[model samples]
Target: MFFAVALLLPAMAAADPLVGVWKTEPDRKNLISHIKITACGDKFCGKILSAYDATGKEVQTPNIGKKLFWDVSSEGSGKYGGGEFWVPLIDVDAVPQMTLQGDTLKVKGCEHVLCAHQTWSRLQS
Candidate 1:
């Protein structure tokens, strides 16, 4: 029926290879989050989808709909850069460079002279 089809449309939607949900590696506090990346005009932007504490339990936070990164420009050879990532835990905006390889995404960010990196996996349907 039309109602059922409409309800299923979102679930059936195919995710773009570069634009989908990603699960971030655990932070220093062992907190993990799900981020959804989407195309914003000619660039890519990401927002926090959900958060999980160290105990693998969902936790509500003020950053639920906050931007994780923005203005991400893609380079050839599966590399992405030229964006700023808002590090929620440390409350800093760092320049982000990302590389996409298969279902794994490698993300590195720098704020001033300090840098950090994390490997994220694509969220499976």
Candidate 2:
């Protein structure tokens, strides 16, 4: 099992193309979160590594280092589906889907039938 799992790690990493740090669009309060998206087996997950105020100054808050979303499965063709994202500001959960194009990612989710969408840019370094 160990050998088989080890052999599959490289393939798993290559399976998902949308793996990297992403800068989320500003929320209603004009705060942006830097989310690190990584591969989790066949799925993907993103966690907040840091946040910035509207002025681009890094802010230290309880939301830092929190899991933004997880279990995002690939739907092929630069699209992913079936993930749950937590909005710390409102303390609400929503089902999320994402579509990636170049360095931009379009994230969409719905909470209680209210849908929200945002565009996140890929972060280098």
Candidate 3:
């Protein structure tokens, strides 16, 4: 049983091209974060793996292991939706939509009339 599960794990993960680490663009504060997207149940989820300053120095924070978004499913054509984005600093949640384009992932969040967008690049192992 263990051997079977181990052999299938890699294949399952490989089935989804979005399952990998992504380097987010720098925010207003010049802070960049690495987000790891993985399969959760039958959907997709992402969490913060690490963070860095503008100079590429890793920074430690309380939200390092926190979930960035969850319950995302593919919407076909490399697009995904149906997820909520959590912002720890503001204590708010936003609906998220994502589009995967080659090595770039376009992530957008919206709450009421306000919306924000970011382009994240795939992190090569």
Candidate 4:
């Protein structure tokens, strides 16, 4: 029983869409951060590849080299739970409930009841 279940785990976990670089809507002035996502253990994590300030100048932030998700184990079926997301735009932290749909990664959460949703596209390898 253990062996069978273990064999299935990898296949299921590998389906997450948050496994590549995601370019934000460049036309939308409000979105200017490009994210590159990869796997850490059984969880998915992302980092800011290009961060632009309001004036469109690249600025360095502490979280730039940080792990966006740590100890975030997979839940199942292209869904991941129990992960924290740090958005550079808001400069705040929030718990993320992320789902992988096709080539899109959807994340929704709130910071102190102020909710926000972000959709990221998967970059081609």
Candidate 5:
């Protein structure tokens, strides 16, 4: 039983997808930031490391250290569910489904029920 438990621990730890920095593509200059994700009392959360605007100027948004991800639980298969993201874009709050594929994370939402997507790529450690 002891040996079996040890083997299982590593497998479980490897499943978390939000463990590194992520950069937005096509226009990486606008939003280049790091998301350090960790477990917070049965829930997972992420924080912004550093963010810059389109002109490479650092943004001093109020949510710099805020919890960008929360109430999210890993659903296996490199996917996370039951979470919402608050970005600087939309005025009204929106909740979208999030997925992780290797180092790539994708978020999907609807604008007037029309499909919209945001892509993030993991930053190299």
Candidate 6:
């Protein structure tokens, strides 16, 4: 039973187009983070996997393992919408729309009329 379940896990994850670890572009402070997207109930969620500072050194942070993306629903093709995104900096939640293209994932989150955009690259496993 254990062997069957273990083999099925990878196949399930691979069935979802967005299920994988993704690396974010360097922030203004040159910090980068990896986010692991996975199935969350019937939707999708993402949590921080790792973080790196300006010197490209791995660092421990409070945001590690925290859910940064939640309740994201597929809108067909590579587009996803209706997700609640968390911003660790100001601790605010925003609604976001995401689109995936090849190895790149583009996200746009909006809080009221203010919108922020981020492009993330897929991390090779």
TM-score leader? 2
What is the per-residue lDDT of model 5 for residues 21-124, given as tens digits with 9 covering 90 to 100?
A: 67754333356665666665444666777677767777776656866666666777767766665554554334556688877888665435655577888885
Off by over 4 Å in 1: 1-16
Candidate 4, residues 1-125, lDDT tens digits: the string is 99888776655545555567775544234535667776665566777777566667876656566655544556878787677877555668778777878888787766778867877777653
Q: What is the C-alpha RMSD of each candidate to the true structure, in Å?
A: 7.4, 2.6, 4.2, 4.0, 4.6, 4.8
Write down the lDDT of every candidate, Cα atoms only.
0.86, 0.86, 0.87, 0.66, 0.63, 0.86
Candidate with the larger TM-score of 5 and 6 = 6
Q: 121 in model 4: Cα distance from truth in Å?
A: 1.0
lDDT by residue for model 2 (10-124), tens = 5775456689899998998788999998888767888999989999999998989888898888887988889798878788889998999989999998898898899999995
Between candidates 1 and 4, name the one with more favorable TM-score: 1
In angstroms, give how far residue 5 of model 1 lies from its true place.
33
Please give the distance, in angstroms, between residue 7's alpha carbon in candidate 6 and its true position after superposition. 18
- Model 6 pairs in collision: none
**Who is ahead in TM-score, 2 or 6?**
2
Query: Worst 10-residue stretch by lDDT in candidate 3?
Result: 6-15
Q: Which residue pairs overlap in candidate 1's backbone?
A: none
For 1-125, candidate 1 gives per-residue lDDT tens digits of 99888666444323436688999999887889999998775678899999999888999889899999998877868898897999888999999999999999999999999999999999962
Put down candidate 3 lDDT per residue, 4-56, tens digits, no spaces. Answer: 88777556645787889999998777889999998885578899999999899
Error of model 1, residue 86, in angstroms: 0.7
Q: Is candidate 4 or candidate 6 better by lDDT?
A: 6
For residues 1-125, could you state the per-residue lDDT of candidate 6 as single tens digits? 98888777556645678888999988765789999998775578899999999888999988898999898887879998897999787779999899999999998888999888889999953
What's the distance in Å from true for residue 15, model 1? 7.6
